[model samples]
Target: MSQTRSDLRTIQPSARIALLSDIHGTSSDLDLSRLRARRLQQAIEAINGECPDAVLVAGDLTENGDREDLAGIRTRLDLLNAPWYAVPGNHDVGPKAGIADDQPTSIGTAAYEEVMGPSCYTATVGPVRITGLNTSLLGSGLPEESAQWRTVERDAEPLPGPFRILLLHYPLFADHEREEAGSYWSLDPEPRQRLMAAILRADHHLIVSGHLHRPFVREWRGRALIGAPAIAFGLPPNDRSVGWMRLTVGGDGRVTAEERPLAVADEVR
Candidate 1:
């Protein structure tokens, strides 16, 4: 029996994925409104030029999680040549622990979903199975956090694919694969260990995360952990260049990833 075109695609030997993170689109409340979204436009153009099979945004699509900001970003992303998926970031989901007193979070689960649907979901592209985790729910203590955990459990079921990738907003840890989980820049302790255990159990191949605004990569427990840089602003003392990461899944279940930086004269943004 001849396989259908769709079936052939499902069994394709390779897939190219573009990972974009921390767009932080323009907001009146935010300074450098010109810098973030404008820089993101350049990244999107480059990704379109590459013509990847799919694009996954690690999160922080908006500076303030404003509906208007999200809508604008949606339009910009619609211009991309490939289908894209995303999880919610701390900014997108709202409320930072240390800054909660002065700058309260504006978007909770409802607001985030109103624009982007469920914060967590499983998507299949070619031979790859990608699961997006809503790391924003990690320490929120909101009712939705429990709901997200349930969703994670349900989606953790192994799918038929050589390449399985998990997309997250916060890095499992800021530095070192064996560091303590709670470091003010990663998933809260309990959730981090829980998710880490799930990935190890599922034998997931890769984990891509953003939020530190710096790029990094490490191999831990037989899985690849990639920290995607921000298209908006990067912390100092690092490259601080605006960029994204590329992941290629090969036929034998092998995966390779590389960081691609946008040509920027100034890394301040």
Candidate 2:
């Protein structure tokens, strides 16, 4: 049931890909959980209406990395009409070292692979090459970290596509590339620089991620870094409407992205 690189269907030219993130699904019947589920369902319906060629989920698929929660979210994602891929957010795979110690320890790579397949993979979608990474393992020093780094190096190699996308859970930085790290919201400086080096070598055009629970776009060394809005809920000091992103790649290889908001019933809030 794993959708590996070879198993992924080759999308046609002029692909329309739907981007969703931070679903935070749970099996419990709490009112908030029900609201999140409803929002996810609405997002799926909207994505199917767009008839995207593929879908990329940016992670945080569950409130916790529990097996039941992961399975529940996977079942909801299956409703998408198009082929879909996902990376694990901190919530889905446990936090990195020195982060959220009060919560469960890092789930390790194997537990995640059991439900989500390989933690790192590359898929071809017409003119685009999408590389998904397991950010949770980036600085964790787990054995899997070395293997994932190899994959990152391989990403720089020439591929069939002119456009490359890096999909992961954490934002490289909250504001600027030179900003200080150790903030709970962004990747630490060491791994951030290392990853950026690989991205520069690969000339990745776009980097998409979640975990900020807000939507914003910024440019880092000429590449677009998009913070996908949370499908479960949005943070304050900005529009809190839950939503998804619509990314379109033209036959000419021009890529554009738009944010589409999904409305939830006020009573549910």
Give the top-scoring candidate (TM-score). Answer: 2
Candidate 2: C-alpha lDDT: 0.78
- Residues 50-95, candidate 2: write the lDDT tens digits: 9998899998888777777787788888999888999988888777
| Best by the lDDT measure | 2
> Model 1 Cα displacement at 168 (Å)?
0.4
Q: Which RMSD values do the candidates have, in order?
A: 5.9, 5.7
TM-score of each: 0.86, 0.88
Local distance difference test, each candidate:
0.74, 0.78
Judge candidate 1 against the unseen true structure and give its global Cα lDDT, from 0 to 1: 0.74
